[model samples]
Target chain A: MTPGPTPGPLPGPTPGLRIRGLVKSFGGRRVLDEVDLVVERGEVVSLLGPNGAGKTTLVSVVAGLLRPDAGSVSVLGTDVVRAPRAARGRIGLAAQDVAVYPTHTVEENLRFFGALAGLRRGELRTSVDTLLETLDLTPLRRRRARELSGGQQRRLHVGCALVHRPRLILLDEPTAGADPQTRRGLLRQVRALADDGGTVLYTTHYLQEVEELDARVVVLGDGRVREDAGVDQLIARYTRSELVLRFSGEAPELPWPGARVAGDTVFLPTDRPGVDLVKAVELTGQDRERLRAVELSRAGLEAAYLELLGAGRDE
Target chain B: MNRALTVARHDLVWLRRDPAPVITMLLTPALLMFFIKPLYVGALDRLGYRGVNGAELAVPGMTVMFSFFMAGLVTESVFREHGLNTWARLRVSPLRDTELMTGKVAPCLVLVMAQSCVLFLLGRVVMDLRVRGSLLALLAVMAALSACVVAFSFLLCAVARTRRQAFAYERVTTLVWVILGGTLVPTELMADWVGSLAGFTPVYWASHGYREVILDGEGVAGVLPHVGVLCGFTVLFVALAVWRFNGGADKQHWD
Candidate 1:
């Protein structure tokens, strides 16, 4: 196989991926509606959405696996639907489900995909060997794909996608069902790939993963993008307040503003917890010695996601 | 072409690892030729057919029988990859559909040719069957038969939605071809109408053409009709297969 011309630094103003008014429907239900997003080179964009929000559909369309009913998708400034082969050559997708052949060994799967990516025989062999080692699959290189554990298989699937060193990698729930160690390891690789100037588009239900990567999060609801911002910006925009307070003798009843109590605990969604605490002590006539532990907390992306979904339901 | 050949090489490696199909491809023709010749001889003697012996008829029939087995094996193997979404992935690559289709057909043709050669050699060495016609005519017949099988196998792959369905369809088709095309018994023993009906089938035409070349001392022109029919079947089946192949690259169901 001959290597393609060294993709000369993705010319022009196009980011790694650019989508405009992308729409798709299944049966009568609209899965993606006017979805627009972009991921610049070396940036990690996390697509966050609840179930049935069309994350997978969007990814599949961009990967050239499915055709969208409306809108246009461009990867590296090339129209994907119009010229699938040229568009797909620069993009790699690691599907949520394991896609490797069960009877083929890990090395075989990597080499096969590497060749598909237009790697020469020498380059393919070297790349496959390097990936096997990097992904910690060297020990199981000879084992058939089906024999590996789920996490191992997941790692191998990602390795296959990376063998070609594509410019943009799309991962649809790549780390789902993986243990903490495996998940972290995969994340590290993903982050490193981004750091190496490769764009990444990932989707997952794991809120913490979005937080950990600090990626630009696009919250999807009802087939539309509800929010797109940095993780901290999203949290700051949606989270209103923080509160920290303590009570004595099985948690004293404090008439705190904007507070709700259950059993001995009082929950307050407020911005000025220190003011609320002083007021609560005066209102409840509780001495300072009776106070227990008090802590302040701010809302996270999880809270924003729930709020977004709740708002979508009401609309 | 390189990408297409790469896919073929990958499949060949897997086939090599699992030797059962290779063994079946080689052994089935030999075993059928060994047992059917004596039975055919007894029946032909009873019918007062004095000019030709059983081994002569059995040799050509075995060649036709091998085509059926090769077709079924190729269908099952290729459809297994299709069911697994491997073909869909390859389709999205730079590899053209024609390349992928050619890669699949090439392997089946090679396997069928090898089987035909083994059957011919066994017939010559063990049964003293004479090759009276030009070797080119014999090769042309074998090539036509293999092409017919490959076309049908690809058609089967197109219609088969799952590996299990492909396997079942292949088995049924192979058995039907073997039985109806007179692989086990001489077509002469059947009713005249039955023999005429068998003429319409590719396997029968292939077997009859081979018999004409190897047994009847006829030139290629004498078996032109048989060759023509087999070629027609090949074209018709390949066209249908290509039609079914269009728009099949969808999101594969991951299991």
Candidate 2:
């Protein structure tokens, strides 16, 4: 085979991934439109979106599996559109679907993908072995993928992408349908990949995963990047904790401002649950006997994401 | 090239893990040749070949007919990638579309060739079937026929929306070619119109090439015309396959 173009030294430390005015359409429906994002090296960015929000389409375009209708995506220093082969060489993508060959053993799947990634014999062997251990698939290495449980297969699917130790890893909902053990292992591996200077772009609807990774979150809604910031920042900006007082019977109204009652409960949105809880108990007065329980619902990434998407939809 | 080889090797491993379909293809043809030899012997006698055993006819006929069935291996392999959702992963790899197609089809070609040659070898050893002509000529015909079958399989894959559609086309086409091309009954025994139409099929060219080498004692130079015709069919099939195939198109693995 003839050698391909050799990459020269970069002018500076290039962003792990850079996208500008990216657009994609399917059957006249715009799936992605003017989406812009940048992720630096050693960073883990969680791509959160609802169904049909074009998260998968964006990932496909970045992985070079789908041609963009317009705009540009560059991995490290290679343009994904013009030099797809060179760009693909630097990216490892594990799509949302489990793509492992069922008839092949766990080890064989890893070896085959690692070989295709241009790893030499020794390096390939080492990488496969390390992945088998990291994904906790060592014990099941010789088992055919068809015989393994769904979680085991899911782990193997992610392992195939990491077997080559790529500089940029694109994992789309890697933990979807995974068991708790499998999810924990994958989250640890993903975090470790980023901590070791690998850039990771993860997509999932599970906001807790984003919080667990402590990743910078990018919320995609209606074919655009609606929110891009740290998880804490998003929660502070878009979410608010709620204080609730449940009643066993017809309850007295709370004096708390902006409190709303529904069914047998009163919900008071709060930034300070401690002071609000005290105010709620005092306001109940003679009807405090009807108060069955007082509960504080802490604000989290899930709430923030829901609020952000809801507001975007409202717009 | 290395990437294509990697894909080819992986395919070979899949075959190794599940050998039932291949074993059936090989054994069924060999068994049928034995049972059908006496019928061919009588036909050969009536044609004025006084002492010719039926192996001369039964061997090549069975070989040509079953090689068409071997096209299933190609369709099955390609469609299985879709079923497993691995097609997207493969496309995302560094391998180009040309290399991926080459890697996927190369093994099917080798398997078809091996299946045809093995059936002929069984005839020579067990039935005293002699190749009176150049062995090189026999091999050339087998190579050409195998290439034609593999190319035809790719065309089926490109045109069929589902695996069931591809298999249905394969079975129907193989049966039509085998009957018209004189695999079961000699073309001369059929109606005059059937004999004329037989020449239109690739199977007819393959059967003619094998007969010239094994029965007519033809050398490589004597069989070049038949080989050239089979190669022509191969080129036509490849051209159609290339035109219709869309690597990015969504194809169903099963109905």
Candidate 3:
């Protein structure tokens, strides 16, 4: 595979959001516990976890909508708990639900939220127009928010959050319940945001999004960070290797160490390739001419996520 | 501050879209004043009470009752947004608590004013309730009543957990105020002790103040004590509402 370009440095620390030792609970149930994360300007960090993994709680606390029992959250150098208004102004939150006003048209909703974010008349107009075009929502600009489809409403929610150009963005399942096409479109825009020097903290159950963005993945289980590492490293460490061997004759009964059979192919897991290849040919009683094909591959992120989550644990 | 207004503007849009509720709120007072008033007057006549016509007495009472309904509508709308988690979205924004409080107060005040105007016009044009006072006195009474309604609504919004609860509380409280304060039926029709006790209710003061201005041609001085009492209620309700608002703690859950 060709090597990708190295990423540029993060934006200045002035607008970065940092959290440390965050903890929270509700009705005697611990939701988030001692969580820590940092989203530097211009970087995208995907918080990957299953449902009920406390991802939302963490984001809420960082957004200053919730106060943690014990922790410190600082946004653009201001403590969220101490200076919530200033900290909140620097962050944009696209809620999990489609939280747009149903009574207003798309443009009106955007204009209202934009104005709330401190944009004036001329700037608000330009910003709303630009967001509409970028999200391909201009066609539905005059439509009341309640009249839009679920995906359209979700897109409008994002547009509302982006209207004022907040430095840090917290997206909670931004593409949840969306069709494949709509999900792709939203992901494209989110990636573009990161490319344009914006910091994004994305939480979702879809592992593919983590892979698509090549973002650092933080896996949470039972309100704790299970792993935090690069996607490639994660796949290498958590996934099992698989090998496919095609033979001309019936499948061999030979002890082909650590191998499984599928149709006429023998799937093997072997680190010693040359030794395994020789053994496979001899065990199959095939000459060099009878060898059909051989392939080696590692598992994807989905497999890694399953493995990390201890799939089929009862077994 | 601008952000709060933005929220309020969006709220206004939502309110306009919900035409059914507005229609019901607008019609409630008219029905009470026009249809039920004659029945009340006939009952008083049969009882041999030498007093003013029941319909005329009910006109001012219905006006204050309309103010109560207006308060409940606005408060319920805001509380519904909170229960649906939309308030969480707003709370996380740059909007401060004061801005949000102001935004909430503005629309309810506007709605109360509108309701008062509609009732006043109906009383004047349709019912021919004689206007003895200057228009300025009537205006002052309306303003005071509107302030009380807005403040009471804010108090309800701060405490209500669900939309259903808010609506129930609003309805029950308004009904109790009307029945006890002689808004629905004249206090003179009740026992003498009950009539005296009704004077302490906020609704009683509001209706009494309006009667002084519209029926007696009294200036501000004539209704100063009632105005003062209503103002006290407003201050107390507003302070409690602000104190009870969640300190940005409702948005912590991911699920």
Candidate 4:
């Protein structure tokens, strides 16, 4: 295998995964069109998209299961297509669906998958033990995988992928069927993994999963990467903070600079809702006194993502 | 090699945990052999075949036939991963197609051999199956037969997309194999073309090997040719499986 460039003193880590001009088609229909994405070391890039947005397809290509019509996927500086075998050890993928042996115990499933990653005997045992505890599967380790609850199975599925501890991990909506608590557990672990220098490419429906992880957002729509930016940048460019001011009787729209009245409330779009709350009082003279209650709504990833997907559908 | 073994161990661990399929594959054939052994010996006696023992003549044939039919367990082992959704887990891993199939193949191979030996042992203790021939020769033939059946199982799995499809193919082919191989009737009674076609299948070699050792007392030297033929069929079947698997014709559970 060709060695990557020698590292110099650097502030940010190099790109662990880089895909360029990725195009894939099935039955004459293009599923991924010139998709480009980069996730640096210690970076968690959420591959956010709705159903049929080609999230799984892109993941399949990167994981070396699906060959792309045109493009290259380099994982940990090794091209997955050209050197899939070399790239395999450096990459771990937790696909959207749960894929564990139902007949085996949770620990056995963990051990089997971990061993496949080429871990040694002692290393394999240690990895499985830590993963079982981390994934909250320690108590249920001896239970048959099929006997676990839905949430528990989902967690076990994630554990199977992470048991190998690959440097570059692709989580294709791992939390899809997980309950809220299970989802939080998975997100927290993913975040901790990233903090420990693992690059994560997580795709999800729940925007909060990405939000809580504080991951960079790579919004996909129409088989293309529509937006790639940090959480703050994505929210700034695609969402607006809405400040709702309910009136005692009638909403007066003559005070706040950006306040728009709808029925009995005035809405203001601002970056800071807390500071803008005082602005509403100072800017509106009699309307502020007439204000019954104030509600500040922050611009969030959920709104930005929906708007992006909605616009893609419109186009 | 270790990777393939790990995948095999994964299957083995699960199989041992449940064990119902393996147990059924073993017992079903043993029971069938006992019922059919008497009828075979009675018919052969009435036909004036002097030295032929009914249990020896009919028991091994029934044993191999049931072994081939129960080879559908191979389909169950491979495709059940699809049903349970664990196949995709292996697919996306570093495990190669050959390695995955090799791992899946070993457990079935071991099970099929054990099933065959158990039936032969039970036949010997109860039904007057003599040691007129070399015991090692009989075991060698059984091992070869097991390989052929196991190889066929893997190939059928590679060709078919679903568990139903694999079993359907297994049913169709096993009937043809049983007929051509002379499991139900003697190949000596078969027409020229039917016997010729049977010669092309692994079943014919297994039955031919058993008769040479058990009835003819041919020993190692006598059954060598049959073992060679069965081994050839084993290679052919396994190669066919590898070809389809490598060609990417088999539908993956991940897709």
Across B100-174, the per-residue lDDT of candidate 1 in tens digits comes to 777777788888888888888988898877777878888888888888888988887777766666667777876
By TM-score, rank the candidates, best first.
4, 2, 3, 1
Better of 2 and 3 by lDDT: 2
Strongest candidate by DockQ = 2
Off by over 4 Å in 4: A1-14, A253-259, A271-289, A313-315, B46-48, B191-193, B246-255
Better of 1 and 2 by TM-score: 2
Tell me the docking grade of candidate 2.
medium
> Model 1: what TM-score?
0.89
What is the full ranking by DockQ, best candidate first?
2, 3, 4, 1
Over 4 Å off, model 1: A1-12, A249-257, A270-287, B42-53, B82-88, B183-186, B247-255
TM-score quality measure for candidate 3: 0.90
Give the fraction of reference interface contacts each candidate recovers: 0.24, 0.72, 0.69, 0.63
Error of 3 at B225 (Å): 0.5
Between candidates 1 and 4, the TM-score winner: 4
lDDT at A252, model 2: 64
Error of 4 at B211 (Å): 0.5
Mind giving the per-residue lDDT tens digits that candidate 4 earns over A80-137?
8898878877778888778888888899888888888888889999899888888888
DockQ of model 4 vs. true complex = 0.63
Which model, 1 or 3, shows the larger DockQ?
Answer: 3
Best by lDDT: 2
Please estimate how well model 1 matches the true structure, expressed as its whole-model Cα lDDT: 0.78
Sliding window of 10 residues with minimal summed lDDT for model 3 chain A: A1-10
Model 3 steric clash pairs: A116-B3
In candidate 2, stretches whose alpha carbon ends up further than 4 angstroms from where it belongs are A1-13, A245-255, A262-266, A273-295
